[model samples]
Target: MSSSHPTPQPWYKQFWPWFLIGLLLSSIAVSTSFAVLSIRSFDGMVQEDYYEHGKAINMVLAKQQQAADLNLGATLRIDPLTSDAVLDLTGDDRPERLVLKLIFPTEADRDHELRLEHVRDGRYLGQAPDNLRYRWYLQLQPDQETPTWRLVGEGRFPDEGEFALTPGRAADS
Candidate 1:
């Protein structure tokens, strides 16, 4: 007597093999999407001239020390309606024009510099864009190509609209 045996199904038709293959393919697809995203998005967090920036740290500290030596303090106020900015700077020597630097914490493109003309004794006037509604790193400097001193402050803008700056606050430590 002769006995007949049935043939087994191929691996492609097996459940475990297809399940494993599906998992591998899914992983590959996910990794490809993440790679594309990283390639397309440019986060502006890295500086090209990191060495130069490091070298400038000493100069910034010197400027801060100069501001402290001058005993500088200021109160900055902004008008919500007219988008006007006024600063009352207290120090021994005041400049004819002041440079107000508004630096956004995360977005470099949102940084702004406004030149405030000296209106009168200790009063400086400038116009700010009405769209500044976020927090900023503020720096007050003489309107020069290279500022010798700077009064640094930080505050959430438009909501409070008024802030004080002093050389004692670590000068943007």
Candidate 2:
């Protein structure tokens, strides 16, 4: 007796076709999600005015040079419990107010600028943010209509204890 062959299945009813379709759909869904994320969130790395920023780089470096020339240095201590920031500045340049900026690495919106009042000696008093924690870049400059010099440092907040800020790189070697 002859064996009858089974009926061939259509593409829609085949396992291979369904599996391929699932993979394609999954990839499309992933790409769509990525597109949405790109539209919704900012990367914060790109500057809108690249030419202007490039031009300003020299000015910034000049400020750093001024700091170095003035022998500017600072030790900053923060008390998270009391939201107090104590700054001991040492330099030939001493202003009435010091501008201290706690900048979050990736988020410009999270940056906080505190104005420190100059007290007796080299001590300056300022209020730190209550929610200070984790990594932060500290920028210390004299509070002026136009700041001429600046010092930079990096440390973790809340547990900062005492950290020193020194003049960063200058335009000239």
Candidate 3:
């Protein structure tokens, strides 16, 4: 009689265990590759060019700071007259000349510019232009800066003390 056939091996010993191990290894490798690719893309977005842009913006802000530093401790007082206007100025130091600028909130509003004429007793006088309205600013700049006084107050009318200009209201008569 023929010998009994060898017992068939269980499916786990024959192939199933190795198949499961291969599947687990392949899935791990794919996941690792995906994570690596994502990290590389994120780093590429933050380049030196982005830093340069930020520095350029900072430079512009510094220039504005320098301009503001040019004026300090300047006082402007406005006195409205029937025809002409008088501006009295007082501070630690005096400026060679004062600039009066009229600003309009909108294009429809009128704007005017006037140079203050210095008079005795630390006073400046100028003629008020017609059709001026809404808001005005008086800026004072000293001839020198060693004493630490550079620019006086801004958006101030000589007659009115520290008055904010509203859009609809006339800043200076």
Best-matching candidate per lDDT: 2
lDDT values for all models: 0.84, 0.86, 0.49
Give the per-residue lDDT digits (tens) of candidate 2, residues 88-155. Answer: 99989888999999889777789999999999788999988897888888889988889999898887
Clashes of each: 0, 0, 9
User: In candidate 3, which residue ranges exceed 4 Å CA deviation?
Assistant: 1-83, 142-173
In model 2, which regions exceed 4 Å deviation?
1-12, 169-173
Q: After superposition, how far is residue 73 of candidate 2 from its true place, in Å?
A: 1.3
Candidate 1 lDDT score at position 58: 86
**For this target, which candidate reaches the highest TM-score against the unseen true structure?**
1
lDDT tens string, model 1, 1-173? 88888889998888999899999999999999999999898686577889999999889889878998998888888887787999999988699999998888888889999999998999999998886786788889899888889888886766535687776442321
Summing lDDT over every window of 10 consecutive residues in candidate 2, give the lowest-scoring window. Answer: 164-173
Per-residue alpha-carbon lDDT of model 3 for 1-173, expressed as tens digits? Answer: 87888899887787878899999999999999999999886644434588788887555444334444432232344444443655655533345555555544443236565677677665767676743334454333323332222232235333444432221212332
**Ranking 1 against 2 by TM-score, winner:** 1
State residue 35's C-alpha deviation in candidate 1, in Å: 0.4
